[model samples]
Target: MAPRNDTAEPVAAPAGAAGLAAAAASHVTVTLAPLTEQLATYLAPADVQRVREAYKFSDAAHLGQFRTSGEPYITHPIAVTEICAGWKLDTDALMAALLHDVMEDQGVPKQELAERFGGEVAELVDGLSKLDRLDFATKTQQQAESFRKMLLAMARDVRVILIKLADRLHNMRTLDAVAPEKRRRVARETLDIYSPIAHRLGLNVLYREFQDRCFEAMYPNRYRTLQKAVLSARGNRREVVGRITEAVRAALPAAGIDADVYGREKTLFGIYTKMVEQKKSFSEVLDIYGFRVVVHSQPECYLTLGTLHQLYRPVPGKFKDYIAIPKINGYQSLHTTLVGPYGTPVEFQVRTRDMHHVAESGVASHWLYKSSDVSLNDLQKRTHQWLQSLLDIQRQTGDSGEFLEHVKVDLFPDAVYVFTPRGQIISLPRGATPIDFAYFIHTDIGNQAVAAKVNNEFVPLRTELKSGDTVDIVTSPASRPNAQWLNFVRSGRARSEIRHYLRTVKYAESVAFGERLLRQELTVLGLELPESTDIAWNKLARATGANSREEILADIGLGKRLAAVVARRFSPGADVVATTAAAVDEFVAARSAPILIQGNEGQSVQLAPCCSPIPGDTLMAFIRLGQGLVVHTTDCPVARRMRAREPERWVNVGWDENPATHFNARVDVIARNERGVLGRIAAEVTAADSNITHVTMQDDAASSVTLHFTLQVDGREHLARVFRFLRRIPQVQRIVRIKG
Candidate 1:
């Protein structure tokens, strides 16, 4: 067997005076020799030949191009390919890495690449290529669209992102040669998008490198100052680090556990972030040391942890057993922070060799080792599951910008492990609500989720989930996603699913409402709507430039077109009659009688907050353009002004016999400013079978205050009952509903 080489092949000169002299003397230039030599160790002869052929093709394609550093553009592709090679990617990935930019920059067609290489390689290259041909209104939109395409492609094939990351890594390393503005832009992009992605994939080594490089580029002065501080701290702690390293090395063997132990320092960016986030001084942040212990087996990992704990006292609540419940990214280890000599904090990570490999390489470990170990297989499975979710988000989201937003939400690294009622563990992002947890289990469950219980205690759906909590979702057939869910959901899947359901429901409601309006106008004209197969329907669709009858109706319902105009088009030559006052009254009654205000009307019908209109309140509706209906109380000031300004837009509306959902109503109270006054008022409101959704306080004087409360009530009767209950309180001097 040949010796193993894990380090990446260097494509450029090292940074230093000695390396510069060597480069100047030899006129060092990038060549395929070193990469080919490295490939021979793992790849077949035929595969190596294919990579060489790809290199030649890419070199010719980029013949006259040069990078900002004045190096042949081919060097960039070779460097990316070499980086992929370090991951032990297959031949197709290697070829794709070499030709990734050809389609975007060289105008090489996809078909040509498909003919030259295999279809897989061509597809991989296409996935890495940006969507530059289309025009966008803003630079941010264009970037988002391009990123959306690349990520969707990556969801299908993981190698696309792997190669893209390698490409980005090389560009970042040489970013200093680019313009300062461009350097900052690229650095920001890397920090915001690529670094999180790397961390999400469990490529810790690459993730750390990206953060450090971006930090240096974004804040050069801060980076230099922090570098000096870290170095100074390192020198001061050398003796302590050496002492701990020796203790671990000696103790592990004595405990009959064979392990490789080494002291590790936190990355520069990581240290800086901790200082900023924790608001600690450099010395305080640097006092904590890190170490890694790689054992030969999983059992030995725990044994090694025990040996280390015996040497130092373990800190309370600082231990995490990832080995038992692995991270969503498939990172498995036993991490414990301990108090070392001189009361300094020491953090240790214990894992087996395979676990260590998976932790560092992430999904790439499957190809790097070519082993069927459970750890590697689990890593691949977890990565595939996450990628599949990306596809799900893409399918539900319509806009590229929205898709990118969803993906960015999922790229967060912090996760909390929770459980279902059945005891199945589900990992979600920190601050995730029960809505996110429900969505994580299944989309259908999420759409129908009405309530949830955490640890057998009923909690709000928007309650932030904590690790180890057993969550049981309560679903109902009639329950659907509320638009308010978008405010609290932390997962991409949950947000996308909620938006998709609302959009679908809104469209259907619009179509139905539009049809009703059209029917009423046709009644005024002594005509009836044609059947689906009627020739008149097709004619009306064509004349109105509508794709279908439903589309025309939707336009009318959305207030984009007038029902009267559409009805007139249906019978253009009919004698027109001037509508009489009695006729108008009858028409108004007919239109308003059937349009009942149901609280669960989705986005098509919104109750105007200006009036807090509920059931039993005489209501009027205004169909604003593209926003189906806005219902309001008859006496609302805003509704009155809108009716005066746009009389034609107003529609008569009535409430259903029973509203299915709670409506928000504001109550103002002048009360004594005594202790527990607010609590008593809240208790009274709740006792009246109403929920207080919001509250605000205003000081009227030192001993008197005005309190405002927003309560969720079923209807006018419920509001009356709440008032009666509040009137019973002696501290409440005055109470009245606030109507706008």
Candidate 2:
């Protein structure tokens, strides 16, 4: 059983205030002395001394500082430390928790902390400190960067995130004292980011608290109403809960299965979410109470489950054997829902005592190095694997906002269990594809994935995998990841790897294009392009603020720098400058023969979605800052508007005579609002050999309707073919292509 810390109680408040009073009552604030005593229960005496020293330093550093509750700010860190101590974290983690706010609030130097404490403790403190003072383009960007930095730190040492989560938890608990607007913002962020992270880490206790607190802060009246409703229901359902508990206890002991049987209620926030998501009233939300059976061993867990199922009729499709294939967070249990007495649905979880500890405490259950077990080691290895993947993602992803997006997508993994050819169970997120499965098995396999077989039948790599499907991935040494995989692959690791590979390939292509453009211009100058003698190009690189000549040329290819300016700088004299000027005009000349498009340039070339320009279209290119060349149709209204405002940024571009891939085109269809209008339009497109990617309807007009479609076509000719087919339809009033 987990020990309770009495000092970690919420602030006292007057009675009859309802939710606000309840929040204030549940808010925890701990003092230094009791926190130290709690640490002494698990930590060594020497470690306890270190924690005391950290408390004194943090307390002194935060002197004269108070929170919105008018309490000394030192109380916050102590409370955070107490939370960590409850997890049985190491002394370094406890010390770091105590001093987490000192550097941010008191401007203490990290080097000084390192010298006073150990380097690891100081590093953890530095990781917990926020980057609020730094400049950013926006607050969202700043937040993303802050999370990115913290996640990277957490990747290095998991203790950083554990402490950070505890800190956030305490803040959420005491959020009622803050201003209303800031309080709501904090609560929403806690729900969006931190709560999901807590869930991912398997910190169920903190996860539920964070969710319930955020729900209360975000919607106080609703929370209060729901709280009352739950209270009333608990009153009405008391006898049922009692009877069920009694039945389970009696059955377990009578069956000679020694177990700890208890009942647990779902979190109020969880109940509220179900009500909103399922469109159910509070009364309709059955199965509010669940029972847990803790046994001595794994076999006993199964036996207890069998006993419970025999006691009550098992609800079909409500049984899940997580013990056979544990959750990603190392949570193991047998979950089942049963139709109990009075026809109420009762949920039950059967696990061992050790499994229960991990289910509640998660990674923190194994934080003590001296008390390691196989279960704890498995938890540590799994956590370290995820953390190491974060480091890999950080290396592949440079943009903080994008990194956070990927991490967020990965956080809430509703997993599906699949099987390899050899029957090894592999768990992946729901809606994951064979590509994700391939990558989960190995990066090399993902990169080399040529084809896949599901249940001995060949399937597309984009096929969404279902549970219990046997998947086999075929690989070839010559194969590499296709950029299109980014559109369908669901796992963060696979997405990151595909993007990293594409970026690398793009850079290499840019270098080659830069070399060709520069060499052609030099040839026009009646001068030979110098080799990488380092002396000539190195001087030019220095003049251009680029690290090397290659980078300068790549910038020219990427349209970051002007080739004209580079040529002028590279010219030896005025005569060469005039010659370079002549070559610039030649380079600017619009021609279909010289400019080629193979449709394989990853990021360097992008077909504008506004016009959906395809092959054999009269195309022009506009270079946006930081984004490479954006190809647009010549007559596109959006392109015309942009060109009218910024004519200098436009350049000559043309499609290849034989382009390698199809393009997306937007088509508008106005037809009589009949039963089969959409079907006829789809059939017409299909007859014209086009694929409709997306469809949307404008309004519910009685006689006429307008439908918009994004379709794949070979070129402008193919689009015209589809349009002609649509115009021939009898019910079609009008059909036009959308350029913007």
Candidate 3:
């Protein structure tokens, strides 16, 4: 399990005024009064009383536990509850916040909490608890599983993550008492996982706080130094800031704009990140001055932008209109950089009051303020879609570690927006390819994607998309995801779906291949293949500890178990089958035919790269343990060496008479070192109807060069034609097919 905060405790009955005074006098700190007062602002009296009861129950459950800071354990839950109250969350969320750790730390049952506080509160608390009872090979695996659990729960109820983030925030604020090494670890995790999540959800307030707190915990010295520098810079920049603020304030009202304008500085962590990423000194980072203009309506946001531009020349190409196309997290603002006093760059963000609230609180705004605004509804819908994608990714991914990896990949904040063929806006992470876009539309589209058109022009599926590009995916039912797609796909959904398809396909292929190999071996043993309903098959499965017959075959197909050894399990008299080598050889010669190879055998059969074996080549296969069959040319040096070492692994394999797909063949050309010589060779190869997949050239002498090319061909006949064509070039001296 992940490291838990030592700060949770159960609740007892709420301390009334006199009870609070008595507890305070006894030095038992009680924080229920302030929490109740905060809740009273938004919640009804009955709801507030319920929250108080939950706090009391939690306090009692946590009786004598203490945090690393030596505070009563109940203080942590109250602090978390206070954060939730500030968001004006519902009474049940507050109750869950107060009792989130009881089930994990106090050993309190979820059933008991449900009976007392209702199922919603109990479920919320359950989501917050880690899976501590399960044993894992490593802390990372355990933490991943626990995170998977919590995130799935959060997907079902957004309130769960809200409360969880509050819990983490409070814990981070009190991290000083933790041991130094552990502090650093927790800080790193918060920065990598929790902070991005907070940002992805549009909780900029929590996100910034998480970053700065983590920065402080992980690098106290750098944080302190940077803090001092910021403070010093603040004094020096005050006059310029005042001038810009006064100029903006004075200009806005004259333009009939009702707005609240204020100057603000960037966060310490934000500044530090800029300096590190851009490789600049503090003084070189000139755009630290930030201003916000809050207006009454969305139209005024643009009007305010024009007013700001009129007051100060807007920096060219530094303006972004996020209002028209809100960010994926539902953040909407018009951002512009302008030349302030003395040409110093000053950044300004203009948004309406509602946008500002949503910008600051993110998804929390959906609950914090009850409104019928379309933007808020859109925000909620977008958040739900993202959460639903998480569940989709988890279902396709088998391991918790892999699921966490996909989620992290999906948490990226910087995105490029594109349009579908139907004009629907789709946002993906920056550097995302067409494959990611396809998957973003639907898994089926992604699985069968064959080609793509970006802005009416055909492009490779791996092309990185830019904002405003309209993309159309061309899919075919015959097309399937290639393993190569995993290299460039940016979306988590695409990666997981492709992997799931490949795994399923590979297992099926393995089972079929295993059956063929086992049948061949049984024929050589003078025994017939067993039927599915045969008793011998069941007995064999039991002896191999296999769950089913297919599993046993899959093992053999994957080379996990030798087919020769398994063939004896079906024979009534293994001694008779092995009685004479001469008899076995004669039986093998009469009945065992070589396995036929099709180019599209998927993962069950692989053609060796050492010697690109195409159809018409004499090929031998080696069954590598747990890796299936690897096909190699008969005379390949590597194959000869492997045969010498493990002759038993060698198998007879022959190419199918009519292979459907093209195969890769390597060719070497010795040509004159002329500028147009390489181009001529390429043209000749193309003229021969072969595609050059890869090429490399190196100078072999003063006037000659050696060129190596990998070409896609139907078979050796097509490859020979390519060689024959290349040999006609005036610069070409000698041509040879590379066999090894």
Candidate 4:
């Protein structure tokens, strides 16, 4: 085998330079022996033996390789496994963690690991492996594809992500050896992506550590300043934190509550984010000290909260009962901010010991699983639910870049927990709408959602839901995902599903149109359109570099491959006829055939809002990527300008001559600024048999006002009638249609 280049571990100082120097001053040394001893404290004899074997194999495989820090490559895997061991993962997870880099760095095959250890460990190792073997067009694409594979692996087995997080955590910890630019890039990615994942998984320790490390790597100066500020603040607030901790400890005991109370300082990154978001100075951010009370039972957690509230007045709107309604990631706690000594706010987190472990370790809280706590099932179920959602998103989003984007949107842990009609808690992204909630309930509900009732009052489908809101969705068989829903829906699954349905419907429609256009052109050449089995169509597809005849036809319809070009391919003997201008004109007329536009078109057809073209107006079409065909009036300056720049993209289109639905038209009416002038204009528009969709006015002077009315009318004739009525009004000075 060719010598494998192992680039998994960065060469930078794994530990911060300050920490390393401090350790050196203390005459401390670290090695795999200490890590092995730590593993021995948790793992059974057989599991320990397996880990030892994994280490030996990894060490041998990476014998010739070294990290940028000039350490044997073997140490990186050992450190990663040590992190996993801290989580007390299963033997398979630890073994996979030890061998995580082998497959990529040492070219060790999955089959080999499966044979040596077991399939589970090998699968975990495979999941951790990158798709470096395959070629990608750009580094971004390569990274996206790698993330996609890793995410798919995680969905299958949550352990994959847990192990991956450990691997990244270690890399981030020692990222000082990497080149400055690369280190910043990695740190930014860690901060943006991995830290959120850790939070979503409920790994609070790793999450905090990841953020701190990323802060240090990305903005070392800012991190040092913040670190110094936090340290100085800690000294200044030591008395305050002590008082609050003592108060909680004293109150809990007096209330007969058995709990472990400790002061929790905010992470440096946390403080930095607060400073940036809230625009506060370090001195102004006084609520940086908090207290955590770990109780023996769930009931005791509530008691602890009550005891603490007795000590300090609870801040209104700051108390959250997450114990009753855990976060989507299965984080359970009673969170409250209390007005402490000197009127400073002091936050408190109260949870059971098991809840604490899960809150910190998240899904990797193996102790909870081992203890047979029912909450473990809840954690697993929630993790699996989110993992399954990834599959659903993946199904709808075929493009790797789009899938990554949707996943990133989901990684943000900020969520609002709402309730369905039946009291089922439905957690959604903040700013999520009724449509997002309906989809989270079920895709069918989303597909058929027509109206929504929040707390028994009807609201728009795009109404942003809030926590504790009881939302009742009214669905209809005739209703489907509105294109407008895309504007308000916040969840990845909702966006992907909506886009997928629209794309599928558009593609199916375009296929039909392409087939018709091709057949019409073929008929013009006196040739019969061949069936799918016809060798001629298949040959034409191959000649056009298309996979199938349908693809060629669809491309023709989409204007990617011209119908005339395909027609020429199928009828090679008609070259002389193709050169004739009249024949080309006939083919063009047949193919164009005035793409009929109704008011209601899917994402494939957009009626240009600039001109507000009605059915009676001459229309032109421009094909936009992903937006399908956009219709505009022939005289629309915006459309004309676009056509001038790219004339080939414009296609002939016309209104259906009698559109069933009313079209929106804009008219400017200059009216005298009078008290009832606006009311009279609306009454006249209503009297003219037109509904005002929207009206905007600007005061041209003290007496004159220009009102822009977006009125719904049948066509140009109806609009003209409304304009005439508006012109007759005594308040109206002049009326004219507005065009782009």
Candidate 5:
């Protein structure tokens, strides 16, 4: 934090001291000299050469182009690479980091990098490239696309994120050079996209750094104000830290536990966000600093926690034992927020050496143990478990934006370290409800999820789960997950599963709808749907992304996807490949029932008095998507007349096979005012076993009554029987089915 010394500093402008200082101030240079020594001390000789080559190549490529702040652009790459180098990334990753932006900003082609550096390095660069033709029209769209890119790359290899983080870090550090609006934009993006990702990956240090940097740019005035206050308050804070640090160290050693104690300051963004949320000032925000006690082993971590609790009273409901229940992001620690000096809540985190390493370096250190300090063999073994979970969530997510959203919520969860009744730890995202925990156990359990028992007490599914509470996800095979649980699910896996379930249900419905329409059309065409027809339709649908023949019929019949356009074109019936027109037509013709109606009351079909369908209607039949059938008289124009134009698409749709939903059709009757007419009409309809939902009567030298009636029927024939029976009422003048 100290400025450069006399030797490095300019006594007099020794040739180009002003330019160098300006360059230093501009890209806001950090001392890369410190990182170079650190890397040489860590990397093997062979790997060192590759890392060196990347530095050389990138430095040369970015030679003349200065950063907006005026530092040679080479410095930006070096600084970013320096951060990645600290993460001990492989030589290929380090190389990619060095050249990450060359493809996007410079005219450097991806091919040249592939030939020169190898495909791995080139592919990494290409993955990091910005959308080539992005119009940047809306910030929201641009952000969405950027998030999509990062996620796709992160899915393949996490190293891309590490490089991207480092790049963003450097950019944020020098954000002052950008326009004020641009600064805010970058800050917002960092907060929204990158910070959460780092947290999800368990890169706690980087996550906090990203937030603080962004906070500084976004709220410089507040940052400066708080910083000055913090400087003045340092004396009091140091006294509290010293008192707690001494007490914890003394208690741990006495309890036969050897540990290293380190103090942690809450990040600026963390403090600010809490302040804004709680409507509190900096002084009122207690527990703003914490202490980490790194022990020698897992058992000692617990013993040390006990010893610390004995020294200071533990705060109620402020403890989390993550050592027993590791976070989804692979973070493990024992956390206890205690009432320390002056009754202020002071948080303490206890961890083993390895847990501390994973807590800091995350998966990176787990892959290769360069440090003489810590072993991450446990996290290394569970790497596949984490990766599999990520892959599972991704597989179920249907879209990129959705996938990214779930990952952010679930992966980098503000965790609830819950326990099974058996004390098995389950870390769920913060705000996860009990139902989310249900699906986490098994899909069938979730699908049949009904009620839950948290600690043997029946709790609502929306109950927010807490850390350390033993939860038993009580499920019955008969119990079912509610569509409403989607509002509370916090896990990516759970959320994705819920969405998938809903989508599946919707698709099934769409298929059923399509099926009903198809059956009606075939009936209208005097074609019987063959036994083989359903299967063939489904197969054709699968090929064309349709679910069934009905969906195809519905699509074609409704003119949504165009039925005739996809009619196998009906030209020569020749599809030499799969699904020829001849095969389909033969299938359709052979199944022909050639629907014939035995006329009961009228020569032509009329709109039923109930569930009215009028002329010029664009209507379609609904098969519950998955359940029973209902036909909507499409737009207000009604259906019967439009049926004449394409009689083939209308099916011999009777009434419900088994009635589930009630249908009410409106009847508007006009007559010269007659008092007994309405009563007589109602009696006749009631005799037909039809019930009216409502009856409205009006007078204007004539009477009009609009009655919505409900009736049970097998098909149109049954409906015709009701109509003919009701027609016998003498008081009824003219009855017409209401359209729409």
Candidate 6:
């Protein structure tokens, strides 16, 4: 870790200077004794004892290790436990938090936790363990996977994420101890994951903290500049808030409302983002200040809002009443930005006592439940339900990479509050579609998604929902996902479902293709083929990386890989020599299964840049190792042009299908550059019912347009249609298929 310069420019800050300062600050600890005493004020004596014992066990298990800042390793867990204690979390969460990192860093077996604690503790700890890997590789693949695992657990029992956020917050706060090069990644993760979780959970306080910490660590210089700007602004704005507060305090007294009003400045990252987004200096950012007004009664909240509006000129389009339609994370506040003294804008948040509590705690309702009339047993049940969800999603999905994507995408910070026609508000991750809304409402609605009504207008399921948009799903028994559904769906559940359906569809399609190919071979053997059975072959096929039998055939069909190669593996002793591919190259396309005409496998076959292949061309396939096989044309100037050069890479390949389905074979047409000539040529193609994929006119500036149409239709005949049709057009020109 290094000391950040906090300058506007990118420069290296001395690491040791920063490390020492952080070491001093980490001394602030809310230990188990005070934490348990706090819990005892609300929980039973037995429960406090249990929590205390859990802490001691965790402390002993993690004895002797030190953190980046040289603090006792116990301090970190204690900090995490203290945060959870604030949440007044249940026994399992508390216990898990105490021992979360033991398994991964200390190599303490999960089985030990399972036996000592219960399966619940072990599971929670395991979910926490999954988060540790995020600190590894900087690759998106690794980060995405790590994010996925954390989210899956979060979705299961939001606590996993809550505990993880606490861990992350402490990390970010002491990020100076980590390498400077590593700071950005940690900051990025914090912003992408932890901050979003705080926002999602309605933990505005934690959200702001996590975001600021990440922003600071990632851009220490920028952070310092921004910090200085904010501090300077605060110093200047003190009188402004005091005046506003005095006015509000006087107004509330006259209105006979009992309220607690607090002035809160915008967090650093929030201010920094606004400045950057608006491209203004910190001083140029006006209206970056806000106040929270906590009232006892809901009625008093409206009264306070009115009094505030009367006190200052209300800024149009800057008011939001979350009380009417609470945020997805159950945040309820009446927000307004008003033009105050000197026409400067000031923002105010109005909320009831309950909302205030939820706002500070975020999703940690333990604090609320402890004081509420609700029974502890009821709280226990909710915790259980939430924690079990992680297990469900984990059981359903095992791919670490995909799991991370789902969490980041599905469990996001921002949210859209939409409604059903009946006006039931539903909160969803931002950028979510009606399809996600449908699934959120009910699985069957998702399975049968047919059409949707957004604000009573029929709309596509893929439409992104907006706050206050009323969404109504139109589903039918006949409605089911096509492969295209995966294209626009935003929900993890929907995506997973679509992928599963597509995989099944492809497998079925592949099975039929494989059997057809097998029959074609057996038929060539002069024996009637028997029906193929058992799905075990598809698994083998997939493991071998072959998709459909055609793909397998295409490999053999193009003579890239010998059919005997696959046949021998799938079924023994299938004829090695008589395959048509052999004739195409060594057979047709290639002789070697893993062949290298030269050591040029990784280089692009780049169609020699001389000839471009259009849709309908006499194409050939070339086998190359690592780069897989490449498709080329028999007469591509690029291919022929290259054959004259590197003759080794010039392997033979013919169309897998005799009348090739579609290919982009280029044709160099020397024509007098004339207007109707291209039209006439295009007319010939239109008449042929084949489409040209591309047209590249040569830059010779000659009167003739060297047209390249990557057209679609049966191979050579398709090209002949363009040639023959053009021949009759009187602007008749000679045409030749270009290959590479």
Alpha-carbon deviation at 679 in model 1, angstroms: 18
Q: Could you tell me how far off, in angstroms, the CA of residue 714 lies in candidate 2 after the best superposition?
A: 19
Put down candidate 1 lDDT per residue, 289-309, tens digits, no spaces. Answer: 699999899888888888888
Off by over 4 Å in 3: 7-25, 372-374, 450-463, 470-479, 523-527, 575-593, 609-612, 635-649, 657-740
Compared with the true structure, model 3 gives a TM-score of 0.86
Model 1 backbone overlap count: 0
Cα lDDT for residue 153, candidate 6: 61
**Candidate 2 lDDT, 1-740, residue by residue in tens:** 00111112223343465444345335545456787778778778899999899989997887645565656567888888888888888888989999997887688999999999989999999998878555788878878888998989999888888998998888887887777787788888888888877877878888889999999988999999999988898889999999988888899888889999888999889999999999999999998999888998899988888888899999999999988888888889999999988999999999998888888878877764336543677777778888888888889899988888778767874777899999988878778899999988998999889889999988889999998899999897756788888888777888988888878866776776666556655555555677888476776666556787778667756767545445544567522222222233343542223345555554666778788888877888886644457888899999999999977677777665668555788888888888888988899999999988678898648899889888989887888899989988899999888887
Q: By the TM-score metric, which is better: model 3 or model 4? A: 3
Scored by lDDT, model 6 comes in at: 0.64
Listed in order, each prediction's TM-score against the native is 0.82, 0.75, 0.86, 0.80, 0.67, 0.66
Off by over 4 Å in 4: 1-42, 367-369, 372-374, 444-464, 472-489, 518-529, 534-547, 560-573, 576-604, 610-629, 632-740
**For candidate 3, which ten residues in a row score worst on lDDT?**
575-584
Best candidate, TM-score-wise?
3
Candidate 5 worst ten-residue window by lDDT: 1-10
Which regions of candidate 5 fall more than 4 Å away from where they truly are? 1-36, 134-139, 246-257, 367-390, 393-398, 418-424, 442-464, 467-485, 501-505, 529-552, 556-740
The candidate with the higher TM-score, 3 or 5, is: 3
Model 2 TM: 0.75
- Please tell me which predicted candidate would have the highest lDDT against the true structure: 3
lDDT tens readout by residue for model 5, 1-740: 01101111111112545564355645454344665676787678777777677777776776555566665666777777788877878778888987886777676998999998899999888777766545757655555556666666666777877788787777777787777877787787778777877777778888888888888978889988887776666667899888888888788778888889998888778888899999998889887789988888888877888888899999887888676667767789988989898887888889887787788877776544554666555565455455556677767775656776776675554777777778777767788888778777777777777567787887778899887677777665534345677887878788888788766654454444434434544554445544535455555666667665556544432324422234332223433123323243333343333222221211122234424432223334321222222344544344455556644444333333343222345656665465677677667667766656556666645345444434434344445555776678765566666555
lDDT of each: 0.82, 0.79, 0.84, 0.79, 0.64, 0.64
Q: After superposition, how far is residue 295 of candidate 5 from its true place, in Å?
A: 2.8
Model 2: ten consecutive residues of lowest lDDT: 1-10
- Tell me the tens digit of each residue's lDDT in model 3 across 221-264: 99999899899999999999999888888999999999998788
Residue 274 CA displacement from its true place in model 1, Å:
1.1
